[model samples]
Every structure is written in C-alpha cells, then in structure tokens.
Target: MPNGQGGYQPIFILSEGTRRQRGHEAQESNIQAAKTIGEAVRSTLGPRGMDKMLVDSLGDVIITNDGATIMDEMDIEHPAAKMIAEVAKTQEDEVGDGTTTAVVLAAKLLEEAGELLDQSIHPTVIASGYGMAAAKAQEFLNDMAVSISIDDEEQLKQVAKTAMTGKKVEANVPVLAGLAVKAVKQVAEETEEGYEVDLDNISIEKQVGEGVDNTFMVTGIILDKERVHPGMPKSVENAKIALINAAMEVKETESDSEIRVSSPEELQKFLDQEENEFREMVAKIKEIGANVVICQKGIDDMAQHFLSKEGIFAIRRAKKSDMKKLARATGGKIITDIEDMTIDDLGKAGLVEERKISGENMIFVEECENPKAVSVLVRGGTEHIVEEAKRSFEDAVSVVAKSIESGKIVAGGGATEVELSMKISDYADSIGGKEALAVRAFANAVESIARSLAENAGLDTIDTIVELRAKHEEDGAVYGLDAHDGEVKDMMSEGVVEPLLVKTQAVSSGSEAAVMVLRIDDVIASKGNEVGEGGGPEGMPGGMY
Candidate 1:
C-alpha cells in the first residue's frame, strides 16, 4: 500500500483467505461472467436455434432452450451471473417471450461498456448514456407499434405461432396456437386501462401418452384427481358442484383429552357418535343439492362411503388453487364450513365426469354457461416431449394474453430490433459527447438479437446486418430476416408478430441489468472456514476470483 506521505499500513478489513477483486479487475470479472451467461443461451435465440439438455445431480434431465428455464436450471454460482439471470426472469415474467434477446442484449451492453471503461469513460456515464438510449428505443417501439384487439383473431394467432416456432412444437403450432388464443380470449377481461388478464384463471395440465395434436382447451376446469369411491357414479349430468375448503372427515379435538370408559357400552357410544357426524356431513351436502363435491382437504373413509351411498361424486384432497379455479369456472362459492353450506353456494355445470388416460383417472367439469376460468390439456408421446410442449404452449398463451391486454404489437423476426438499432444510433449523434459513445454502444448491443437470429439461421452475419441496415435506410424498416429462407422480408406481412411489451420490456430489463453490472467496480467475498482448500463464500463465482 502507498500513501501521499510515502508510507502506509496494510489493511485488514476482510477475514483470512477472503477473495477480493477491485477496480478494472472486478469490472472485467463481472462483465465476463455476464457475457458467459449470455452466450450460454445465445444459440437458442430464433427458429433455427439449438436446444440444451441439462441434467441435475439426481440424474433427472431437462431438454429445452427457453432462456428463462435454462437460466433457472443452471447451477449458477456467480453473484453477477445470478443478476444476469434476473434479466431473463424479468422478461419472462413481464412479457413471456424474448428472454434470450433480453439476456444476450444485456451481456452485449456490458461488453460494450467494458470497452468504454478501458478508454477512461466513467461507468456512471456509460450507464446514464445507456439509460437514455433505452428510453429513446422505447419511444421508437411505441411509435411503430400496431394496435390489436381481442377480435383480431388472425393476428393473435400469428403472435402465438411466432412464439412456438423454434421450440420443437412446429408440427403442431397451428393447433396449439389456436388453443393459446382461445384460452387467452376466454380469460381476458376488458378494463379501463385495457384488457386485464389473470393468467391464474387459465390452468395448464400436461399428460404423457397421446400425440401433441391431441392438445386442447377445456371449456371449464380439470382436476387431476378421481372419484373418492368407485361405487359413486362415474359421471353426473346437470351437475351441482360444491367447492369445499373444509374436510369431510370427523373433526378431531385440537388438544389432548382423556376419556375413561369403564364398560364396552361407553366405547360403543363414542363410536356411534363419530359415525353419526360423518352421516351428518354427507346429509348436509345432499340437503344443499350439491351432486358433486370437490374438497380441499382429506375425506375420511367413512365419509367417502356415505357420499358414495348417496350417489354423490366426490374428490378429496384437491389443491387450494384448483378449488379457486373451480369456483371461478362453476360460479360456486368455496365454503369453509360444512355446517354453513346452502343451496345458494352450489354451482351448476352441464356434466361432471371421471375419465382415465395414461393409466390415471382425472375429473373434468365442463359446459358451464360461461366459465371465467378455463383449462388447457397438453398431451404428447413422452414425458420430455409433453413437458417441452407445455412450455411452448405456456409461452404462446402468455404472449397472446399480453397482446390482448396491452392492445399493442410489433413485427417479429428481428425486425423491431433492427429498427430500434438504427433509431438509437441516429439519436446517439444528436447527444454528441463522451456519453454519445456509450449511446452508440447501446445501439450495437441492441442489434445483437438480430445478429444472433441471423447466425442461428445459418445466414452470413456480415451480409445479413448490411442488408438489414440498407433496408431500414430504404424505408423498409419492417423488413427482417426470414429464417426459413435466409431472405430479408416484411415480418408483419409474413405473419410474424409479437407483443410490444416483449420488445420494450426486453430493452428496459437488459439495460437495467447492464447498468447494475457496469456500476460494480469491486467484489469482496468472505472466505470459507474449511480445513484444506480455498473454498470461498456461498456465491463467489465458484472461486473464480
């Protein structure tokens, strides 16, 4: 250590063997980690991108290239890398698609900032400039956004199809996309702010056995359970459904109690009383005119028998979330107490039935007058295929819902990114300062998505960018790469569409992440208290420092 007085004392701020990185060293380390994470998911960007097969310690495997899923499943140890993952998560949560674009764009922003840092530009300046560029890019996005409505079924289907394009569900994109649109339209409600959707109102259930073509949306709800007893009718028409949060079993004392019975008659009395309570519960349900019961808690064996003898179809131990959806779908009230039940609390459905598929029984409640909540059942030939199809369908549904709610959309297939790049680059010239360099860097980083799309499609990257730029210059800003043919074409006319929220959210999330990483000029990790090796704190980039 050195001081102006030509003398200094060694600082002992951290514990023994603590790992520390400072100044350029720390910034580079963090930036490199961000880049590493970005590149990890880069190849999964477009229709032709590749999928990853991730296996865990227990030998369970996941195969997909969805950016948010990949980042979640990865065993990331770097604190900075986790920050990068948050970018993907935010994109997924906010807009449901374009996670790879957000992540790689964030990484490229950091990589560009690293160059500025080398040339003596302040990190805050770079962050501020990037922020300004991002805001302007959003303006360009909104100005170019096309209005969409719930009735715009064709465009909505295109949005869903674009989302499912590269996820190994291409063969069934048209069918699954229709299901996504229908599901979203069913759950979407018009609000003063726009159409507001509660995706919880839509449930997705996946079963392994049938081909993906069998995937379909249910008019009502699906419970992944069966009848409590086989003696009960397997199907009930004109079903009066009761959604119960309370258990049908006899209530046990909450505390310990002692009962001393000197004779067998006394014990028999206790048993009769318990049996009568079960009979009373079943009788109460019947009195309320509920032919079908869905319980959130366990039903005792005695109670199940009574329910079956009464010709009532009942399911026990249903999930609380499922009960909520059922209430929404059937227009029933979730009764917390059996004693408080009444006919008014019962909901009506055309039919309630139990069906077996893939060697398991499931209950379906359908044909409600107008269900507020709906369900989609995804089926495939195998577990892995079904799981992946479920993911693809979910992404499609999410984007369509967002589009319906926001009432705004943009051309997909990298068209928006290329236009955004050109707009931001021109805006950088007007700022005219050291910050201008950072702004230009922002332009380049935003273009990484288009580049990745081209590269993944096996097109020449240099030629692709050159032609895209020329097209934008020629006032054909909506023209983008058609990955299927390696040609520049109009994305909007080609039926490639995405929700505007996806692009703006990606820009905002990616820039914020890049700024957070850029401003971190130091990293201090405490040492691990091990007997032998140099294992640092829980999140020390796996000892990379």
Candidate 2:
C-alpha cells in the first residue's frame, strides 16, 4: 500500500467500520461515565439515605440502599462505569461494608483529576499522588482505630448496629445486632494469623409470618424439613441424636441379575429377608440409645415404620451441608456404618421438635448449650420485607464477623473520613511538590463522604463540611457528622462505630480503581453483529466519545 514517493500510502489497518477514541477525548468520556455511576449510588449513603428500586428485564424487583446491591442490580453497559462498580464490590468483599463510601470517593478523585488535567497535569502524577495519599490515609485510620476483642459484646453490637443503620430492618437493629454478635462469636475460631470467622457456620433462615421484630438466633441448626413419617414422635426431649450418612436400606447388587421365583414360598422368603434387614438397622439405632435420627440418605419404608414404632424422631434425606452443620452444632460425628453406631457416638440436644410454621412443617433443633453452629430466623410481614430484612441481617453478621476477625474498630458517621481528610492534607503540605496537589485533591475527595452523609440527611452540605472541619480541628479526629441531628458530635461517645478495616479497604480500593481508570488514554470496542451483514442494523465499532 506504499506510494511511489518517500512515504507509505494509507492502509485499512482496522476494520472498515471500526472507530476509536484516544488521548483526552477517551479520558474525559471514561471519567464522565464513572462519575455518573458514583452519582447513582451517592444518595444511598447514610441512615437518612433513600432506597433504590431496581427492576430487571424479567420484571423482578429489588429495593435496598446497600451499595453492593445497587451496583449488582444496575445493568451497566459502559466499561468505565463497570470498573467503578467493581470498587464497591471489592469494598463489600473485603470489609463487608462501606461500598458506597468507596465508590463515591473514587468518583470524586476522578472528578478532581479532571480539573488537574485541565491545568496540564499528567494522569501519572495524579495517580502517584493518590497512591501516596491512600497509604497515609490507611495509617491515619489505624492510628484512630480503637482496639476491640471478641469478648467486647457492647462494642461488637455497636459494630453490627452501625452496619444495619440505614437498611429496611433498622427498627429491629438492636435485636438483630445482638444476634449477629452472638452468632459471630460462636463460630469464630483462633487461627495462626488471627481469629477467623466462618460466616458459613452462621445460617440465616427467613420465615414470612411475623414482623421483623420476631427475628431470633437459635443455638442449634434448623432443618426446613420435618419428620419423615407421621407415626414418628413430633418432639423429642433430652434427645440422643445419631448423625448418619448411610442409607438405612438394603443395598442393591452392583451387577444386574434376574431372579426366577416360580413358587410363592420363595417370594415370601425374599420379602421376609428384606424386612429383617430393615429391623436390624432400626435395632442398631435404638441399641445406641438414640431418640433423634438425622439421616443424609434415604430410609426405606420398612425402616421408617420400625423407627416410628420405636418412637424415634427421624428425618430422612437431610442435606449433606445440614448434616455437617448438625454435627458441629450437636457435637456429634457422622457415622457411615450401622455396625459402628454406639452411645458414645450420639449427640445430645435438649429439644428436637417439629413445629408448624405458616402452614408448613419445620424442624428446630434447639437448646444446644455449647453448639458451634447456629441459625438466625428472620421473620417479616411480607415476602419482600423478609427478603430485605435478610439482606440487612447478613450485612450485620458480616460486619460483626469482620470486627471480630480484625479486633479493631473506629468511629463511624463520617468521623473517620473527616479525620483522614485532615491528616492527608497535612501530609500533602509536607510533601511540597507537583504530587502534593494530587495528594491534596485526594484529601478533598475523601471529604465527599461527609458531604454525602450530610446531603443524604437533608442538611446543607457546605455548612456541614465547614462545621465538621472546624470541630475536627478543635475537638479531635473523633468529631463527625451526626446525620440524625444535623450536628457535629463525637462519634465514639455516641456509640457510632465501624470496623477499621472497612475504612482502610475503602480508601485503598477506591484509590486503586480511580488510578486505574485515570491511566487509560484509549478505548477500542468491538461491536458484535446486530443482524446479518446484508440486512437490518449495521454493526461496527463506535467511539464512546
């Protein structure tokens, strides 16, 4: 394609309809998209924040103010906006809260970076400054964090309550918070690195009958199923439970075989042998002094009849996961062989009862004095409310778990953000270079969190910021925006606290996302075929700008 002259002629290096955007055009478009995403979730920040009602293409609806939920529900198409949304996801995954704060901070950072770009500052410089500020911001958060322990019930409840402050279940926060702290403490185990909380060990079940206030924690696992046979006991007290993974039925031969039974006597003998096998299995279970049988496999009809005749409460085909949780909750081991069953292998439970709930039968294994696994039953007036309450309870549980694992917490209600802002600005001034501007910009961006809190609460954003800054300067880092009263107060004294890891992770994740988005200077998108090339809408790569 080279011309005869010294230079080469133009060649169609890209596809015929391909389009691209580079340099400032691409950067500005990406920044705008990210900022739009941030604004979408900004109003859903604090206790006074409004919830978003997201409807999918299938007409399924979700109502919540949780940042992660909003991000997940929104069908975002823009790549840059998707990246911003991931900031919230990362925050949610790492600290279990503060997703809104993280995304808002990242959006604000990009907004500030756009202004710097107008002043001839390079994207690299802004990213570098953000990196420095993020590191220092974490340091400030650590310095301000108050030490907590697994035994700090009051503070731990505060953590859970703070996490559930703005959710639909806010009215039941105190009770749910107590349950969250208790559940997390129960499942928490000490590892070599630190205390670890396996959230899976804490199961949350929702039953829509009563109001959210009826939610309570169970010391043992709850099975959604009831007794396998009606003749079995409806309730068992002082129960000796057997955890079985094997089927209480005769095993079929591995190879297919044909049995020729010409006489009725031969058939009767075969039936009698099967009946004896079932009786033997039941005999072994009863011989172990077990009154409650939780099986992971099927129980033959004859076996069920024999167990019911013995007055044992038996539930067959229990989920394997439920079986494991049952083992942990009951301090029992799952036995695979009937011959190995013994009294020593039995688990103790004060009560095992089948209760009728909302016209359905449910099994409750309650009153395990030292059970490791637990369940939280959430009740609400409607299905939607119950679903929302479950989300809120899960958030509370996660936050409490994080607090226990980290053993550090800080004042909430924008207190940590305000303090980090002041500290970061101080560090910016000390740096004294082009990067200092970026660092200062990062500090200003961090203040967006407080502004968002005030804005969501229907307060004057500028006035609230000024007052918060003045108070932080005068009182200390603990002074923060009390959105409830539109006043700057000491968050620590007010019992408004969050896990320190939440704030630190928000800053780090937000900064990383913002920096990554800012560093982009080009966008190349491949458009898929809308229809056949010969008909309908055309398919081609289009420049976002």
Candidate 3:
C-alpha cells in the first residue's frame, strides 16, 4: 500500500483481534440475536405451551416451561440476547409472572423496527415512537384493572390457578392453588396502601416418596429435623418453645487460655464447674417454662442429657433462616443468651411433634394460634415431579401475593394484550408523523403476545389474531383467545386473570429492551481472550476497557 509519497502507514485504534460493527450491520446483528432468543422460548407461553428440557454440561437436567427458567438456563453468548433475557428476569423479579410475554414482545418490537429500518426510517424516530406507545400502554393497563382483595378468595384462587396452569400440575391445581391463596392470606397484613405480603414468610419445603395428593400446608413453621437426644420426648403438647441462637455448651474464654492442673483435685474441680455450667443452661430453659428448645447452635452432650431429663424436646443446629421463620411463626423473640430468656419469651404451639416421612424424621410445629410464617410441604412421587410442582406452587404463591398487594388484576389469556394494542393503536393515530409509524409498530409488537399465546395453543396464529381483532372491534376489548375452546371469549368471565403488575412490567421492560437495541448504531466486541500460561485471559494483561 502506498500514499501520495509512495509510502503508507495505518494506525491501530483497537486491539489486534477486536471486532467492530457499524450502522445497519450492527443493528441487524443485535436484532437477530434478540429475535433468536425470543423464538427460542416463544412456544412456551400459555397453559397449552410446550416445555423445554435444558441439560447443562454436567448432564443435570431441567424440564420446565417457565420462561424465566428457560432464559436463565440458556448459555447465551450474544450481548443483545443477554439484554433480552434480562427483560424476562426483570419481569419475574418484579411480578413473578408474564416472563414469556415480556421477551416475546421485545422480539416483536425489534422485528417491527427492522422493517421500518428497511424503509429508511431513522432509528431515533422508531425509538421515540416506542417510548410513547409504552407509556400509553401503561395508561391503558390501569383502565383495565379490577380490584382484588383478601376476602375475594375465589378470585385469588383463580389467579393462582392461572399461574399454575401451564406447569405440569393440572390435577393438583385445586389443592395447590388453595394453599397458595391461604399462605398469602395468612402472611398478608393490612397496610396504609393495602395488603402487604412478604413472600419470605411463606416457606415451601419439598419432600419425595409421597403422592402429590398428600401435599399439605402447615399453619406453623416446619423443621426438617428431629429431637437431639433419643431420651427426649418425641412430641410436646401445649408446647412452650424458646428460640435460641446461642450454643448450650459452656462458654469458652474469648482468647485461648489453659489451666495448668497440678493435681487430680484441681482437674476434678474443673470438671464439676463445667458440669454446673451445663446444668445452669438447661435449668434456665426449663425454669423459663419452655418445653421445646430450638437451638441454632450446637447443644452440648451434657446439656442434651439435662434437657432430655427435664422432658424438654430440643432441636440442635437449626438454620438461621429457619430460626427467623420460627420467630415469625411462633410470635416469639429469638434470644442470643440463655440468661436473657424469660417466661414471656416462650412461643406457644398446640403441639410440637416429630414425624417420620420417607424414612426420615422431620419435626412438625403446628397449631399455632395465628402464625405469621407458614409452610407448604410439597410431596410428590419423584424428584423431578416434586421439583416441578414446587416451582409451580411458588409461582402461584407469588401471583397471589402480588395480586393482594396491588389489589388489582386484569384478564389473562392474551385479552389484556389485545386490548392494549387496540388502545395504543388509536393513540398512535392521533399523532400522525414519522414517529407514529414507530408507535403503530409498538402496538403490533404488543399484539405479538396474543399471537404467541395462540400459536403455542396449537391454534392458527393469523386466524386467532383476526378473530381477536374482530372481537375487539365489535365486542368489548376483553375478548381474547380461549385456547381450550379455540374461540375468542371474555377472559375476565372465564376466570383467566393475571395481576395488573405483571402486564405493566412486561410492557415497560419489553419496550425498554427494544429501544436499547435500536439506539445502538455501533458495536465493538473484544475477541474471546486466549488462555495464557498463568491461567488468566491472555489479552487482558492490562485492564480491559
């Protein structure tokens, strides 16, 4: 190569292996990545949706139709695909449902944006149109929300059932949905805004070897443990329990110290003093009228003997998290020191017993007067079945919790989405400009949610959308595809409902993801670094920018 002077030199701005894409090429690459991810999980959208079996390099398997799970499991490499997956994560973290709707809508937004790009439309114009549509879509969502309350058990159950529908838990939906609602209700408290449910208060414990029918909810905390000593009573009636974080063993000095024993008398005196310390700890527990002691730390052998002798059923080494749940469920304060324990610190339960299940002993703490923390013992015949059922049950719990918190719900089965499309499209028409095309494109992207639901249900996507549009035109916009009947019907009346929060989150995240992809006109990617002899990426000798 030669310059005007017959000599040439080129400057290197980036690393030797760095790859950079500009303009339409970068946009197309990003959009394609998003679309590919969207297509990957699009089929798993509704009750009739298909499940994905993801196996990792270690051969561990996960079979689920959960959009969040699928996205999290996929080993995605593309930056755009990862960003798209983040939408599903945000939807799940925010609302606990409608993850599929979020990703599908984002993909369609980019798909529509791609078409507008072919028409020489500016990316900024498309992004501006999408922003307007997203904001308008949220406004439309508020109009469609119907109030929900704790007293509305039937509606709450319906919400739970809707969340559990597509998971492989059809036969047990009734029982599980009931438990989900009941758990949410039990933990729900009146707040200035409305009902507040802390999902952490509702604990789910899974056990295998029993049929799903045996699954039940406990009104109190359930510990996967047994009494510490064989001599301890297996059950305590009218149990007065103490929740302790401190170990029952004799306290050691803060720094290492040793006693230089000169004779057997000194050693014997030391043994007697240690025994008295153990005796005092157990005596303190019994003196406080606590018949059941749940210790977070170890119980010394001598302390265990004394507790057994005193007829106190003690559980050793309880998890700290479980200790918190017990404190919530029992309405008792957790004491760090045994000396601080008093009669008033004792938590009451009608019965605390250990039961054998699957040949293992698990303690059941039940019949609390009013437990703030509750447990759902998920039982199933196999590991996979139990895992799947637990996931489904938890999703139901989250949905019920969110519904009660928001006090609002919207029609499901794609009804809300189609309605949103109709409303936003009308809004788009009033603003007739280049941006309006992008706004209209946003409306179509939202409609893709319904189309995905229809296609997943094995219905003809085009025909379903046509019928839904027709229904929205003449009848109320609540009419959506009824996958079971293959007809468009009112989702609200049919009891296909979802929390209003999920819908708004899906719209917000989907549009944001699409806009993020569109605004990026250039992408510079660092090449995969080669492993150096020192086991670090070779190209990262200096800080990676």
Candidate 4:
C-alpha cells in the first residue's frame, strides 16, 4: 500500500514477516540475558558467603564481598542488568551495607515470580501477595530493633562492627569502628540536645606523604610550605589577632578620582597621607597586642607590608569555615568587614600548626573548647586503602547521624521491605483488579533491591536470590531468613519495620529507578532530554544529593 509519505509499504510479505519475528526474538533475548547475569553469583550470601574475584576487561582484579564495589567494577551491557546495578547503589547510598543481600533477594524473587507465572499464577496475583508480605515484614522489622541508649558505647561499637563485616579489609574493622564511635561522640557532645549521629557524615580520607600524627588541627589548608615574603615573619607566638572579611585598605577618595599631572608635589602629598593612615592602622593593631591578622578577603600590598613590618603573621583568603574554627580556638569574633571592626574587636590569634609524620598530614589548633574542634585523624597504609577508608568513614558518619537522630537503623537496607513484599503479593492474590498490578509492581520493586545486593557482592544475582529464597523456604538455615532460639525468624516475621528516614527513601527511590529501567522493552537512540520523560527512574530522579 502507498503510505501517507508516498512510499510503498510492504503488505504482509512472508519474508518480511519472518524478519519481524526475528526482531521480536532479539528483544525477548534480553529477558534471558538479564536472568543469566543475575544467576551468575547466587551462592555468595550470608556471613559465610564466598568472595568474588572480579577480573575486568582491562585485566584488573578486585576481590571483595562489598556489593557496590563489585558491580561498579563489572562491564554490564543489558539495560535490565544496569537496573540491577542501580539497586546496589541505592543500598550503598542508604545503609552502607547489605547491598549484596538486597540484590540476591530480588533476583530470587524474580526467578520465583517467573516460575509462578509459568505455572499459571499470573504476575498480578504474585505481586499482590508480595505487597501483603511486605507490610507484615515491616511490622516484624520494627519489633526487632534493639532500643539503644545514646550513651551506650558498647552498643554503638556493635553497630559499627556489624557494618564493617565482609568489607575489603577485615583487619581494619576495629580501627574503622573506633573512628566511627569517636566521630559520633564528638558531634553528639557538641549539640545542645545531643543530635543523633548519622554514620554517613564521618568519612575517612587517607593521604600519603609524611603521615599525620593524631594530635593537630590546622585552621588553614597547608600550601606546599608557608608563605614567603622578606618582611613576613616566620613565627609569632601569643600573638593577638584580628579577623576581617574585607580588604584592609582605604577606599577610593574624591581626590583620587581627579586626574592630576605627574608632578612630584602632588605625588608626595598622596604618599604622605597614605603613610599616615597606614601608621594609624598599625598603631591601633599594636595597641590591642595584635601581632597577627587573618582576612577572608585578599590583603593589600600596603597593609601586608605594614603588618609584616610589625611582625604580624597575616594570612589572606581564609575560608569562612576556617575563620570560624580559628575564632572558636582563639575566643575571637570574626569581623564581617574591616569597617565594622571596633576597638574591642582585637583578640589573641588562634594557634594553628601543621605537622607531617610518617606520610600523614595533621593540623593542630590550640585553646579550642568546642567539640567540633575535635576531628579524628585516620591513617591508611596505601593510596587505595586510604580512599576506601575515607569512604568507610563517611558512611560511618552518616549511619551514626541517622542512628543518633532517629534512635534506630532502617531494617538494614530494606531487607525487611523485600520480605514484606513477598507476603503482600500473596495477600493481593486473594483480591483482584488494577490493584493486582500494584502488587506485582511492589514485588518487582522489592526484588530489585535483592538483585542489587547480589550484584554488589559479586554473586550471580539470580543464584543469590534463589539461595536466599531457598534459605527462606527452608526456614532458618540463613541467619536473617528465619529467627531462631525463641527469636522471630526474619525481621519481617518479628514485626520490625523500616525506619521512616533517609535509608528507606534511598532504597525506595533507587528501586523505583531500577524498575523503570527494567520495564523498557526496546532500546532506542533518543535525545538526552527525552531519556527520562516519564517521571524517570526511582533513584535517578532529583533525590540524589
């Protein structure tokens, strides 16, 4: 037939029909591809799970059970598999651990759901049942939370140690845990009401050169070395200080605006007035016992020379944060502008020192009473190790903050939620209608979490889920699957619930994002703006901080 565009179109030619069938087959191939990738690392679950050795295309090898790290190292091509990867990112971004668990659970759930679909149990029914189960599971999770006292350091240590298990460096767990606790305590002690410590905030950054000793605080970032100026003094002790947010120079006067000839008479007159003003400023600073100046703005050459001659240790271009730290240390007030400086504004300069030892950098600030002045000095043996350590520290900080703020952790990366979805789907089967899709969607959402965890742990996502489901079906073989010794089976079985906090937000958002990607049946080359037209993916939205 002739189409609207005046091009003759094929009207069901057998040969073309066969070619279309092949295209459909290619699309269907993604299903198996996705499932196969998920099935590759199933057995590595639980505390006793084996480690995965990921050999990249470039031949670099990574050995670990951390979910996000493993998935990040893999070269995944399938859209569905990428969806699985997003889940791990969610878990990592939220709970800092349990990503492996989430991925394994999702893969297993999807496998079982697929089987149920084949058995004539529609996707709708299975999904419904999953929703019911998820609700119940949340209840169980809430019941399982061990109410912890903020002052209970032992319990805090337990929490930190639990997060550290199955990480890249097991030997460093104690060190990381201690650092976590110290950071939490430091932050908590500072707030008026002792704010909850989120473990994610306290990150460890390891830099190598000359290692830093544990006792030092620098209010200023160190350059390769101290500033060099002939008039500038090397050191000043017990020096009075003034901190200004503005440039320490006179503003343009009306006389300066008028252009004049290059006459020595006028030039000397300008110089004399400027010199007097400069001397007066210096005299004022000296009267306050101020031998040092810290400015948030740039220093003028004239003022720099005047301060330098007075043996003032002046530092320019200081950050507001550093200024605050310096003020806290020295019991000084930060003047917003030089014009705002009053006679009483002068104070002793904070003692800020830097020391390098054994390839670590440390900053020292003296006479600071605020708890915020205290910062942990984390040491790492290698560059990679230091980076990882720093990441771990940051995770620890956020977790600590959430724990202190909310007084609980969110069911360990939405594991409870997945378990609940299984139950919810089961219940939904008893009812019927559009709600069935909701049930399926929720189940799919939960399964996504499991798959992400498995991928992160470097296990076959499908196999890991299968193993988890098998363990779940077996009752108590897997630690988290079923409770034992008079305890409730899974957190789901115990009436525990996900915390209504950042953890849940990240998991749900990430899972939704992953599911949106998974739902894609075809791949098309589209413009960037058209990529996420339909509300985009879950975690892929505006939620990423």
For all predictions, the C-alpha RMSD in Å is 3.2, 3.8, 4.4, 8.4
Residue range 1-545, candidate 3, lDDT tens digits: 57689788787899988767789887887787777788888988898889989898899999999999888888766677778999999998888888988999998999999999999999999999999889888888998899987899999999999998988888999999999999999999898888889898988999998787788998898889999999999999999999999988878899999879999999999999999999988888888799999999999999999999999999999999998988888888899988888988888888999999898899999998889999999998988889889989988999999999999999988888888888888998899889999989988888888888888888899999988888888867778778877888888898989999989999899999999988998777787733221112343211111
> Against the true structure, what is each candidate's TM-score?
0.95, 0.92, 0.94, 0.64
lDDT of 4 by residue, 1-545 (tens): 88989999977534321211122232233334445444544444333345677777688666655667766776665445666666777777766655655555444444545454455554445555554544544554455454555676655665665555444545666666666766667646435764645332232335543222231223222322233245766555555668777766766775647757589998998888887777777666767677667777776678778878877767777767667655644557888755456657755533544346464434343433443433445555655555455555555555555566657653443354445456556655766765465456555656565555445445565655665665555543212322112222344334322233433444344334333433444444233322221122222321111
TM-score of 1: 0.95
Q: Which ten residues in a row are the worst by lDDT in model 4?
A: 536-545
Per-residue lDDT of model 2, residues 53-125, tens digit only: 9888899998899999899888766677778889989988887788998999999999999999999999999
Off by over 4 Å in 1: 1-11, 529-545
- Write down the lDDT of every candidate, Cα atoms only: 0.89, 0.87, 0.87, 0.52
Index of the highest-TM-score prediction: 1
Pick out the ten consecutive residues of candidate 3 with the lowest summed lDDT: 536-545
Residue ranges of candidate 2 with Cα displaced over 4 Å: 3-19, 190-194, 255-264, 529-545
Sort by TM-score, best first: what order? 1, 3, 2, 4
What pairs collide in candidate 1? none
Number of colliding residue pairs in model 3: 0
Candidate 3 TM-score to native: 0.94
Ranking by lDDT: 1, 3, 2, 4
Best by lDDT: 1
Global CA lDDT of candidate 1, please?
A: 0.89
Q: What is the lDDT of residue 185 in candidate 2?
A: 88
